[model samples]
Target: MSLKREVLYQKWRPKLFSDVMGQDHITVTLKNSLLRNRYAHAYLFTGPRGVGKTSTARILAKALNLEIDEHGEPKIDSKISEEIDKGKFLDLIEIDAASNRRIDDIRSLLDNVQFMPSSGKYKVYIIDEVHMLTNEAFNALLKTLEEPPPQVIMILATTEYQKLPETIVSRCQRFDFRNVSNSEVVKRLKVIAEHEKIQCKEEILWFIAENSSGSLRDACNLLEQLSIAFDEITISKARELFGIIDENISLKIYKMIIENNISELIETLQDLRLRGIDFKSLSNSLIDVLRLGIFTVNGATEIQGYSSDFIKNTSLVFSGSDSRKLITILEKFIEMISIRTEHFDPLLDSAIIHLTYMFENKRIIKEELNQTQEKEIKSPLNIDTQNQNKNIETSENNIKESKINDTQSHEKGLEVNQISKPKLDSNEKQDWEKVLFDLRRAKFGKMVLGALLRNVEIPKKLDEKLVLKFKSKSLHDHFKVEWQLELAREAVKKAVTKVYGNGIKLVLEEPDEEQKNNTKANLLESDIVKSALAMGAKVEEEKEG
Candidate 1:
């Protein structure tokens, strides 16, 4: 029988401080401390997983006990050093706090910490995922950390440093590790590929690096899987194995959107569906491409992975203003994806179709606004309470102007028909109340529209436009849907006709961070939230949409 081979991540683990990649700050500091013989008794290593926290702890252990050169490099050929490398050193203890997270376990370790090293000069203990320890275990360990034995060195590693007790964190010397950058990850992978004699395309390394999200261990594992699956690793094999959508497909999708080729776009989407392409991954890839495009348009140079021709085409397609709009669109899409639990196919299709005609829609809306501004009709029943006489016509034009002539609306069967209006005074507040009341009292689909606009900021009579400022994004996003927005626009115009008259555009403003926080505070103080709080329900803060 053949001997089992060591995994690349394990085999390629760094043995010296200089061997650690993308953590020069921590490595250099640790090396300095080792050279000066001033290393701390208790150390805390915290960062995202697979970023060499454990490996660094092991290296620190070897450095503290083993013989080192003038540059603080441990002599790995020594018997004790070899034992540490193979995880068989008696003085170096490795504990998985996730599995052994009890007061008894901690007490047992503390008992061992008081004893002198069997062979080495100092006893080294590495506790990984230390945040998983219970409160009792943490309390038990705190005293030892506060006054540790002179010969004992404890290294605690955790991915979630926030969960660690402040007392424990304050007692230890902390070192934070950061995610390895893609370029650095690529270089490291290339080094491993050359050493391992793996014949793989360079793109395959980038593919692995991109997917690993800066975790070198993840990148190495992915590359190892691909290397094992094929004699010579290829991009197609890696992508197919991982179910990753090809960048070329994403590039084609972008081109289709830029060209507004709905027919071809739909055809391509259908083909992707037939080929079992993951829409979620495709969305992410498009977002990456859009980000690169934005950077390339904004004077960034030497961008990798994308060809020069692709960069030139991207720059030609997007201006500074278009780049901002693209960011907004991407944000909205990401928000939609996070909030909704539905499948990605429909959302992907909707986003692509919307982006395809977004330019045309903006152009049409601008032209309509200009025409409305140029041609104004006199109002038949003008009640000017502000003493500012303005030529404002009926809001019939505003209602139709807000509707986008697109297939999405037609498919949804949405239409804005004229509704009988009740005459109102020129007071904007009264007009808002009356409009909201009409929406609530009307025998329509649900009272959703009224509930959505209950807390909206009402414009003043002096205001030329009827701006609808929502308190929260949930309400704003719901109201900003094409069909819902048109419906609300139609109703608000009809109700506020006496105040603003014609050429009054209905605007929806996205709330700022301050507004969102203020609104959230207000909601928390409401009776409903109070009741939930009384029922032992805690409100955790969520990410901004």
Candidate 2:
């Protein structure tokens, strides 16, 4: 029979300091301190789950108790390793502080600490989730902790250090464990896969690593589950098994949101719902997708395993400002979902509806801005206003026309003043392109320029009005707030004026229904499916539109 997962975990688990991955800092410090005969009476090991806090605690116990060779060195004895491996070390006592969180438990443990060890120089007590201990229990343990028996060592481990009383924390030597990086997790997973004789793709492991969110235990658990689920561990199979949303689908969602395809987005959501996907997970996945889109738009190409097409397409779909807006929306969605999940209320429906409505309104505003810019370009305004001054000389024709066609000429002059006129020579165009190129090169500039290029359409003539269109109503509405739109407009104006002189008016618009509906439908289908898949929903292909 194949080895049980838990048994395998026991067999492959870090047996020594060197076996633990991605926690070298903690391990090395402890080892050095132990070797030098400088040992803390109490240690507080805190971090996120599966980063090796408990494992390190156990290792410390073994390291402290085991005999050293004549060279004043701790021998890497297999017998000691075996005893610790089976948890039969009489001197080492492991306790789940979560369940035994009472004064009696602490008193009992403290009473036993006074006695001489049955074996080895030190008696080690390893308490997991020490933060869960009651105040009375902590108080009882405090006196003993402050002046513990020289032979006794206390190792306290917790995921949430903040929950523990400050007094208790101050008394102990603290060592923080961090979440394992994706690369580290991937590396470990690859090792496990090799040992298991499992055929797996690196991308699949990468996905597992990403989804594990820095928890080695979580990644290992997921890998084990997937290995059991699939006979051949391919990337596609991993995606299906783990409910990973495809990058393409995520990109589609970004486009839909940008394009403001509400109906299609809803339909896509419904499709996901039908596939037994959790709404909360879907929302979270969408947020991650948006985050990735934002990263791509900002030209963060170093993100591991992000597809070239995803980066390129997302860069085209979202501007920096647009990405910020999407982030805001996703945040709100998260908030709403969190509140809904926590407390059942009729107001949640209203909240979702209001949010959706605002999103649509933003799209409409963007369309309107785009249209305004277009109209402004097609009909350049020209106006002239004249005031007669006794000290000034004026032409007779101007004076005559000022009186006879004052209203029409004034209106025409106003129109001309409002309309932007470009005076760029070929040299100027080249200069402007260079400026654009430079802007694209800088990190901040790339984000700004990418957003501008995606959302704002520049006219051929330098004098023509600049039109800014948004794919989503939410973004359009968000753009109206404070200096966001103004800043973007100013940036473009500055760039143009630097090269071609300042003769252009900038206009922002929202598109018409027909175009929006069509775009929205296509975008919604793509994005929803992508987002769903990313969140780990299984997608079944249907007839294409």
Candidate 3:
């Protein structure tokens, strides 16, 4: 007979409450309950796998049945601990509800619940994957659950709590287990590596922790696999074996975006694909990188699995707002990749092309702005005179001039410059409205436009500064403190310049208290408010009194 390589309970598993990593609240509560003899008849342990759901259940069982030694500490006797460890305990029944989900299985189990335990004090039943039980089986178990035998204790574990029936859930004491933190997972992995005498780098263990995504069992399993595959664990070998994209690739992609190198980005993606890189996984990895970039921008230096070079390079390349924008783009790409398996290569190509084009467009706009500013500083009078001359023509010329003038004027101000909003004729306002409507329909455009709409107002006539009134000084302060104000100001300038002509200055102002009060009072006296009041309905004013 061959001995299995499976981990035994005593060798690696946590023996006491304090030994369990990453579940302090749960362990503490469970220990108090066992110490006070306030154990529940049924328990529902739900969380991501390997965060100590089953392990906690077993520990609870041991605390409940095991006797105290002469030293006044609980004694895990070799015989009882071995029986429980091997799943051979007469009173401890560990059932996989996933495989035995029939009503008959529940009935058979419930039929045996009447018998008293032969040795142990309590009949501990640990039913894993309890969510997989059939509706019929759930109903069959409900009666016994509501009133189980005096010696019976049930610990039901499931990954999906939503799948369980409400009746069954209501009868059990539920504890929600959360995903382990990156630090906690790393800490546990370090202990495991040390125990196995594995010469693992901290970076390698951190990678395993991050890749495991908060599952300790998964992390341990990955570590064990890596240890067996290589004589010693190295960061380079782990990245290769796991098919993880090198941090250099992620940094290069970010640099390409920053430098507006669409061709290089596409070529890079092609090179990676040729190396048998999984586009979907690569996309996901890109999203993670962007996410970590965001955290780094926020001054978080303890992100799991990130190399020192990655941190330093990402910090150098991305500003806070830039990281935010990248996160948004990566999120969109992730959603696109999730549903798109067949067209992965094409999709990757499209994403690279789209991002490259975006970067190029931004670069062009920035260069144009810089040139315009230089021209303004050097020859402000020339720009004004040329724009005025362009406007002073026949009706046809005026139309052409308006188009040219608006394009030139708004070029310096549009934050996200995708379209050229031309001047309107008789029905052009309606067309402009349609264009705005379409822009607002787009996800990114909508967010930017929505902010502008809330904060900015248009007035009739050119050279007349547009008024921007905010609801709160905090909003005004935030806009001023962040680049959002500059971005918003530029967008409005573009829109106005597109509609009017060059040399239009749009001013953002904070309205005085008197003006705000008057505006609020007028709104209260408006027909809408009066009509609602006339219908005997109570209406509270939204604006300050």
Candidate 4:
């Protein structure tokens, strides 16, 4: 049988300081130090994994043990270099601290530190994942690292620098390797593909780079894996291997949400679930496209893997306002997904429903505001009043017009979402259920606001201040947004006026444990509350006009 080829990561490992990609800050400093013959005895290399930490350490070892040219770059085609590559070099000892992390192992290492180089100029010890060493082992290694023999150089590499002792870290010159950018990773992959004679598309390289998460070795390995699996690498094959959802599917879902087509959106999500699409990937892809849409709205046009036509279409589908709202909602959805849960299907359905409902309601509210612009019902928060007299006239006209519209709407079988002109008799009691019922018919997307208030209760009712407490923390958090709080206050103002014959100041709060228990006990004791609870409530969905 033919000898198996070495893996791409090993085959394409950096050999010289100049060859390390995307970490010029560390490499340049090391090169200058080497050239000046002022390199430290111990070094600490810290960064994310697969970003050339070990390779850089090995290269440093080779430089220290071998003679370098005037440019401070050691030739890699020598006998020592070959031996180092094959792990046969006596002077260059690479240890995986993860496995050999006991005090005995470190003591043995300290015993070896006193010896001179057997053949090379200096003995180099590279301890990788150095943070995995036990407390005793770290303590044993500290004295040696602080003052090693003149001929010995200790280089420590760890992904987690925080786990390392501060005393050990303070003894060495630290070099932090940065992640390889996608563009740099793609450029490096192109060089490799050309060298290996692999047939692949540029987009496929980009796909690999994106999924590798800034690790050049991961990108190279993925590219090699694809080359071996397929005669020619393609996007479809790569996506299938990685379980990545297609961008078209993500775009379609975005379109459905923008168009407020909830039925089709749910059907599409169900189809993807049936076909075993990774929901996390789908969510991430949609977030990317929505981000792209925001960029397009702001006149950016160079997003990768997406055509100008796609950008143009995305801009048309997701307006600036739509992008902002969808992004906020999707961010929350993704956060919920991040916390591992078994009921992902139901969670996804609920998220999609929430997204579409919020989008549709905001759009409807915008349209209604535009249609009523001629009436000039200026919100006190948005527009400045000319004076008290003008404000009073505006308020009186608004009340009179609302009364007339309420009467006319009753005739047309459309209930006006406003306070009635007359109040209840003195003997009649105010009803919380009636407030919620009236809220459902309030104007300017108050129906959506009413749905949010479904679990709200008056845990602490004070005169002039209505403390509406939320049972669901999520619902309570929604009101923390400034605009949502304003909308809630407006809906409550109308609903309370219709039910209690006057509007009170609104105070939104989350129910504490004691308040929650007290509210529950009060609900059980009240006949009206019990009857309302038994009857239950349904949110009034906005109908197409």
User: 61-161, model 3: which lDDT tens digit per residue?
Assistant: 87767874433234676687777777788888889998999999989899889999878888888999999999999989998999999999999999999
Clashes of each: 1, 45, 1, 0
**Per-prediction TM-score:** 0.65, 0.66, 0.69, 0.69
- Candidate 2, residues 166-204: lDDT per residue as tens digits? 889998999999999999999988999899887788888
Q: Write the per-residue lDDT of candidate 1 for residues 11-67, one digit (tens) a residue.
A: 999998888888999998998898898889899999987889999988888888887
Q: Rank the candidates by TM-score, best first.
A: 4, 3, 2, 1
Ranking by lDDT: 1, 4, 3, 2
Residue-level error in angstroms, candidate 1, position 296: 2.4
Q: On a 0 to 100 scale, what is the lDDT of residue 263 in model 1?
A: 92
* Cα lDDT listed for each candidate: 0.73, 0.64, 0.67, 0.71
Model 4: lDDT equals 0.71
**For residue 423, what is the lDDT in candidate 2?**
32
The residue pairs in collision within model 3 are 413-490
In candidate 1, which residue pairs clash? 393-502
What is the model-wide C-alpha lDDT for candidate 3? 0.67
